[model samples]
Target: MTRRVPARDVVVFTRLFATMIGAGLPLVQSLNILGRQTEHRGFRRVIRGMVRDVESGETLSGAMGRHRRVFSELSVSMVAAGEAAGALDTILGRLADFLEQHGALARKVRAALIYPAMIFAVTVPAVAILLVFVIPTFESMFASAGVPLPAPTRLVIAASAVVQGYWWALLGAVPLPALAVRRALGTSRGRLFMDRLMLSVPILGGLLRRAAVSRFTRTLGTLVASGVSILQGLEVTARTAGNRVIHDAVMSSRAAIERGETIARPLEESGVFTPMVVRMVEVGEQTGALDEMLTRVADFYEQEVDTALEALIAMVEPAMIVVLGVVVGGMIVAMYLPIFEMITAV
Candidate 1:
């Protein structure tokens, strides 16, 4: 019965917790204050439970581990590392920063797609209304006038008749494909295939790749900076990676590192990381600055994602408008051709 907390809310909570702890407030006291102030009932319940557990002598990270639905593996691992190092405030601050940056990236992507999605949402139903109602009325008028309909007009009317006849099937068609896709993604192979396919998609593929790399590097770097071992960091990063391809690549790299192979070499072999990233990682390893280098890579790719999203939005907005216009205009032209021809004859 627990509600899913939004990433933004989690980020805010983490920031406030870090600030309160840094200001010398006790952990239990901070949780109590935050829990009372939390507007989300589910999140409040989670906070209160953590408070009770903390008061019962459980470590903060251990208490959070019990609510895996709210606190991710990354969060728990970071907190555990913080507690071990006696730098819980610093780790919580870093966690908050990571969450905020990740949420910002997601928001940008969603924002870029919003206009095109809205256009399609409005256009589809408008076209359907024309097809289902408006076109049929015109067809009856033409039929009663005993006028021979033009080929285009006849085609449109036939389409309208089909739509009217198969309305239920048409409605079912929407969710059935989505349900099938959801089911497919539930399987490991299906998820891997889809993730690979996503990387090959035109325009969006590059964006997705950069975004995935940004996420991978950022998560790994943050974990490493917070004192998580490379292997453990990679494992956590892989598990949380939204794309299967990235996840597999990180796991492969982790396995290689376990065998004493360099991280860069395995990542390069995985074909997910760019040559620049590989070279940077190699240099970082040699200089003992792997965490710093990874952080740099994350920063670069996050900027790249921003630029790519902007370019994509600019291209998609016009393209969607043109497509919508062409579809609706074509149908209108098709329906009106017979009426125009009859008027011209008279």
Candidate 2:
């Protein structure tokens, strides 16, 4: 099923609209052109609405603000900043880059998780079918021999019997835990707990943390560079932080900033940020180039995230294959062991 204005569509729209505006087309004209030429039904409607709003003398930011789902608060605020500074084209281009970069990072992480999930999804039913059906056909022949079955054969037979008897219970079990977890995740406390749990996992947790840090820094840096305040940037960052733990940390940082603490101080205290990130923010605050420094931190963390994810994918791919092999191959071998023994005796 098609989504309601997928992110890739927004990225393409931002880049193309930025190009049109950079070429000196009027805002309304650019929107009109994009609205007509766009293929996505939902986004095209959004663009048409924007064009009408702009025609009614609403500012571009104000026009975009009406479509918050399609245009993030970060984008809306950046557009406002660009409008104030008379640099709409530049801000749009920068926003496009941020969207594209963040999207790419997200896709990498998503692919890493999805690969293993897909393997399990396909393999589980196949194994279940073998146990419930194919294995039983060999059971009677093995029993009629009145010979002691090997341990592996016994184990397989037992499992096959359990599945045949308790298949409904096993099926009901899978969704019960999933629904409970989904319910838990719908709560604020549960979300925080789960997010924290995810961030504490070994290699995967570190990769997730780095990705979150990269997203936080890059988003705030882009906003600051486009002339948004740290307070405002933090608010936007918190709202868009995806993870509840990071969101709370950012909100706490905002509260600290309100109390005259340096931006880095509260973040450092949050225990989520690494010392390197804290130091970079400190230096940026001291040097009055906080935006540039944040950009640098984001750049470093982004590269780190990419490298870590690549390594993770490399490790996980073969590991998943091995798991699949062990589950299916090992079961088949186990079931055939008694036959192999009988043939050897003959």
Candidate 3:
């Protein structure tokens, strides 16, 4: 069965689950209520399906597990742990909070990029106008006055000619390269290479790594606290970490754990986890408070991700400003040069 959890359904379902559990309603009643209240056809169908599954005596986790597309592994594992431990309500609450926080982080990243994107959108047309419309006016005057065009003006005019004449070609050319790049990057080998490349990038790479670590630790911690075994938790965590590099490391760590090694050892050996993380995990393993320690690690790294995102935005803003200035300023200067020379020659 195709996994079919629309985004709206997940958000609504989790929140409704949290409320119903908090209200002490029976599970089946809650799901039925949600199914009736849901506006989205897809979400309504999912809820109805879950209700039917529950009516048949299937555990909520087991039912959700069947819809792997809608419910993430992390979510399912946590639900399963919650069911086993009789803490399903608490787990539902936590799941809701986690989803909200994750959504907030996504929004922050998008908001941070908006300024530069707007600048680029505004500047591209400004530059194009100067080159195609403004520069040509200057060039025409220079030609009528029999003035010798400077190399800069000549280069600008030539660029403007190409842009004006092949504007449709220019528009069509962008999608070809984009599609080719997308196709190339979509392959497994290409994705692996890209993941490595991204992790090696300076600021963005660090941010991504931290985000992955935070997610991994948080999910594992939640699962362990809810009574999932380390092996099962690791399997779920690896597949849901969202970064292929971290996912591979988690899988490797799981294999090592299954072979009778402690979880911390495999993680340390993987080199994906930092020393600080490994030391924390080791201490957590020793003290039987691994879940608490992992939660702390997740909290600490979430802050780090926030800080890194802020810094990245700060760095990118100035870089984008300089680029916009250079592109627009160069075009204007190129157009004005010939006009200045003509005035002086008169």
Q: Superposing all C-alpha atoms, what RMSD in Å does each candidate have to the true structure?
A: 1.2, 1.9, 2.5
Write one digit per residue (lDDT tens) for candidate 1, span 230-297: 99999999999999998988898899989999888878887878999999989988999998999999
* Strongest candidate by lDDT: 1
Candidate with better TM-score, 2 vs 3? 2
- Which residue ranges in model 3 land beyond 4 Å of their true spot? 1-9
Off by over 4 Å in 2: 1-3, 344-346
- Estimated TM-score for each candidate: 0.97, 0.95, 0.90
What clash count does candidate 2 reach? 0
> Over the stretch 207-310, how does candidate 2's per-residue lDDT look in tens digits?
98999999999999999999888899999999998899889989988998899988887788778899999999999989999889989999999999989988
TM-score of 1: 0.97
Report the number of clashing residue pairs per model.
0, 0, 0
lDDT of 3 by residue, 192-277 (tens): 67777888898888888888888899888887887889989898888777766787888887888779777887787766789999
TM-score of 2: 0.95
lDDT (Cα) of model 1: 0.93
Distance from true position, residue 135, model 1, in Å? 0.7
Lowest lDDT 10-residue stretch of candidate 1 = 263-272
Candidate 1 C-alpha error for residue 268, in Å = 1.3
